[model samples]
Target: MKEELGRTIQQLRKVQCYTQEQMADAVGVSVAAVSKWENGVSCPDVTMLPVLARYLDTDVNTLLSFHKKLSEAEAASLISELSDIFFDSGFEAAYAFLLEKIREYPGSDMLVLNGAMALSGAMALSSTLVMDGDQKAAERYEEEIERLYKKASESDDPAICSQARFMLASRYMGREDYDGAEALIDMLPDEQAYDKRQMQANLCLARNQLAAAGEIEERKLMLAANSLNMVFVTLIEIAVREGRLEDAQYLAEAADSTARALDMWEYTAQLPWFELYTHRKDRDNCLKTLGSMLASVTDGWNYTSSPLYRHMRKKEGEERFGPRMRESLLSAVEHDERYAFLRDSEEWNRIISAGGGTDRGAGQDET
Candidate 1:
């Protein structure tokens, strides 16, 4: 509290262009006292708060408060920082860190929503605590996480409110609280008409912001394409499970073609075929699909190569893997027994030797 109060005082004084000496004189305190307050070495006496607030053109409440709002970029950055802390220092550290942030920005809807998400995700992974007989500690964390999400769900910002509610519903579902989940889900908008992205684009167009509107639509299109790809994969899995090999094959082909048409990464495009052929134990087709997949890995892929997504800027640190991805893939193939049949094959040897060797029709016997 002292540190937060100190920061508020320093920020307000700077905004008003007041020197420490000036603030000291106006508040009837020494320059050193004002400096100490700003540095968090000490705080103003209770009676001096009103005088300080008056000189700073703010009420005592405002003078003592932490910032209540965070810009979009600031919120994203802080969330990423919290994730790093969670990974590097462990859940307890990250939980405490988020608690401090929530205290510092009690009214920030973004902070509250994202902080809840971070803690909830970490808490899920910390289930070992419950198993280790620390049930009370885990329960406390769950209660706090739920409270934050509920608080965020009441925010005036519709996006934040909806997301918080969605997260709460998901948590309830995870715990088999079907009634709680259903109640929260019922509160959410279920139709396309309530989609904020399209609404934002429409508003932009109405304001004569054509370029902004186009960008929004393009991003939406990209996301929809990705979702469609996932649906195709899911359908293929279901078809295979139903013993409909022909249907599974057809869906796999459709998935592969859809990926190419949408300009998705070539490696991802070939994965459906790879999985289908591996399940069929079609050695030649498996080798062919694996060869194509490995070649794509060696060839470097990005959205810039896609005509559809070129205009969209990729987020920093978004790439899932780096320079060692190829090495890792090769190691996995060598270790996994599923690929044991392909180990001694000439095509496999060549493909492995050449790092997904040049286009080989060597295993193209599959009609």
Candidate 2:
């Protein structure tokens, strides 16, 4: 044990480019004592552990080689911290910080996967996207994201690989590379059992609980539903690119249905997502989609809170949208000129009036 601890100390010191004299000086020990510790002729007394860990940029337990795997909460905190860095420092700084942390914790698949998610979200959500025909900047983020996903896919841990494969599958779908997406999804099992021998070791290491068959399917369902939501958006975009307005509408409807089934109201914002209705002079479906949005959000339907899919939240158990959600969606669509055709329709007036529109709020249904 002493020799193992000495070896770890020596390795960390050299990796940090610290000489025996420099390390000894930093830790209030003699150069001879540092040499003795590295040679396994002696151990650092308990008093020196904190100083050594600080100098080496690690904790005392790790310095003493008494390492423990990061618990679930610790892993979550790390991911959250990385997210905050991106928000505060911009993507370039965050990316550099992430790579540094990955090197600092090389074996943690959780860290790698979470970092990949952060990068991908930053890319998709950034509003200042350069729309050069090729979207070269977007491609860079996507490429890096794919590289990180590949790294996680290669992990021996099923928990990590399952999520990586799902994200990669969604990316493939977004690229319209259907075969690639399907192939990745195929890698996931239809069911996994807590008592299953093959997963016992992996489960024991990461979660320490067996995933029951029901739990396994629930995970797959959530993954598939979420991935499919994005996948349909990709398909809709492709249809729009090809100028197939009807096809885009059909795809949007399919995506909306799937989202409703999963209770992922986030997709509701995109109900009439494509601008094709106004472009093609198709008013009925446009108004219909808008009406559906109104109905979906009316009477406090709780679109984002399906018990089965609550885990899909950006913050678990928190409402993804606020009470102002209905107002925001209605206002955006109502003000868009593309839907001006519906301005005088009785159904449209009633839709507006029901939502406290000054035109006739008194006689309208509160719902």
Candidate 3:
């Protein structure tokens, strides 16, 4: 811990191009004391933190890092609190709050880690609202996503580093930077946990540990379900790319049916149907499908009659896509270049007309 403090002091001082003697003079300490602190041979008194922090232009918390280690439970609680702040206030406000937290505990890799997660989640929620020729918001979000992941990549925590590298690779894939993505992926630790888990499961079975075996079997079942979802997802993506719209829609429905059976959270699974309808210029069917799909998910009277919804949670901002997020997602679909033809259609206009002052509730889907 003392060694870490020493390194922090040295790094901050060097970033400002300050020598040991200069730092000591600024903080009214001898060069020998500064050298000892930086060398890990000695630590500074608590009383000297303010002076040391001022000289380094940092907070005492940053200088001390974590004087006492945070428990996993405590860290999880903090993560949840940060998430709530994000949903309650707004992205900008949550970002400001996270920045302050990072400054306060500069060495807390979890802070950088959670910030990356929050920003990444916010990007998805915000992108739904982006439309053609209005990409300013999307650009800002992607830039911040890159910045946060890059910061997390430098974290000391292995878990934090691993997740950051993977997310960075994903971002590179989105940008078609295949080489960059491959480089990032190459830095990740190889998957050993799978082998270990299988070994443990085998051991449990051999020992007649029925309870343990059941838990392992449950985990294996979950993994199998996820694998099935991935396979179908890839096929659906291929269908969409190939312009096999009907096939894509069918596969999507199949996937969603399986998803609902597994009690998983569902998102906008019908957006592709809109694209297909628009492509065929079948305005009426397109609008009907859109209206029905929207009706199924939104927190409106339509949900009351839908068999897909048994009892809906009315939590304000905790849905798979919350009210604002759903609205934004719909806007993104509306402005997609492929569906621009629908923008002028009377069927589309009908929904637009309904979305006036008389029907402005975030999730009020009315035909």
Candidate 4:
């Protein structure tokens, strides 16, 4: 087992284009030490096994030839690393490598599950890319996603099954198969210990899609509004992306009403008022409302310096439309010291700028 582990370690090192000297340097050992370990003349000390495993980007057991002896957490970590490689690297390479590993670790369910997850993630990524252009590739990705979801659903673990169900619903929704998606959602246990809000959101989205396909405009509007309010914060995002300002306004109003109905002032406070202001073109009113909202938001988190705030300020100064309003909003966000979490994220800047690297013009057409 030790010899096999040494061989595997050597193989992975070569695959990563690392020389014995380089590997030794990374693991804090001598070149002769690495050579001796690889040749099975000697093995790394127990304390160094973790460092070696980490450098090799494999599990310690895999490097120590004790695949069958790993704890559950170790096994899970191995699966996770394999999934990352499969998703981040080319499919052909990941597939070839997994096929080899499966032959060696045929009894390992963790290995099999990781392979499924890797395929699913890859398919989803490919589908998103192709859905923007190549119809055939998009369809292929959808098919592969379904296949992987089915494989995952066969697991007895509730958590795994719930994830599979969610992915299946998402894929079905992507294909506009609302009925099939809803059917999968219906199969989920009511008391299942999963992310209930997310499941509910998916169901709401499915219902909205179905309503949009129906004959009743009033019913469609109501369902769409209900769906939007149920997940208003996210719906605002979708509306903005689709350049559907009127839709955003409708959803925002609905969200406001829903929040009132449920007495969820805190949640309602998080809904972006600037969205409604943008649609209404009531710049002064928008600024006033934004001031209040920003104050409340800052009160909740404590104002801290954030990349988003800085970007917003810069864009506000540069852009002609709503520059003053944005600047005011930034001041509101910066007024308190509790909202420190925003500074932790580098993407905050991109988020505030709509990822377009430009100041948004105020009166541009929705498209």
Task: Give the per-residue lDDT of model 2 (tens digit) for 142-179.
Answer: 77778888878877789899999999998899779999
Model 2 residue pairs with clashes? none
Instruction: Give each model a TM-score.
Output: 0.56, 0.46, 0.62, 0.36
- Global Cα lDDT for candidate 2: 0.65
TM-score between candidate 1 and the true structure: 0.56
Q: Which candidate is the best by lDDT?
A: 1
Ranking by lDDT: 1, 2, 3, 4
- The local distance difference test score of each candidate is 0.75, 0.65, 0.65, 0.54
Per-residue lDDT of candidate 4, residues 214-288 (tens digit): 323333333454455557767776887788978877776767766445433332443445555544455444434
TM-score of 4: 0.36
**Comparing 1 and 4 by TM-score, which wins?**
1
User: Backbone clashes per model, in order?
Assistant: 0, 0, 1, 8
Which has the higher lDDT value, candidate number 2 or candidate number 4? Answer: 2
> Which portions of model 1 show Cα errors greater than 4 Å?
1-66, 119-147, 194-214, 237-245, 266-301, 319-367
Candidate 3: residue 56 Cα off by (Å): 6.2
RMSD of each: 11.9, 10.9, 7.5, 18.0
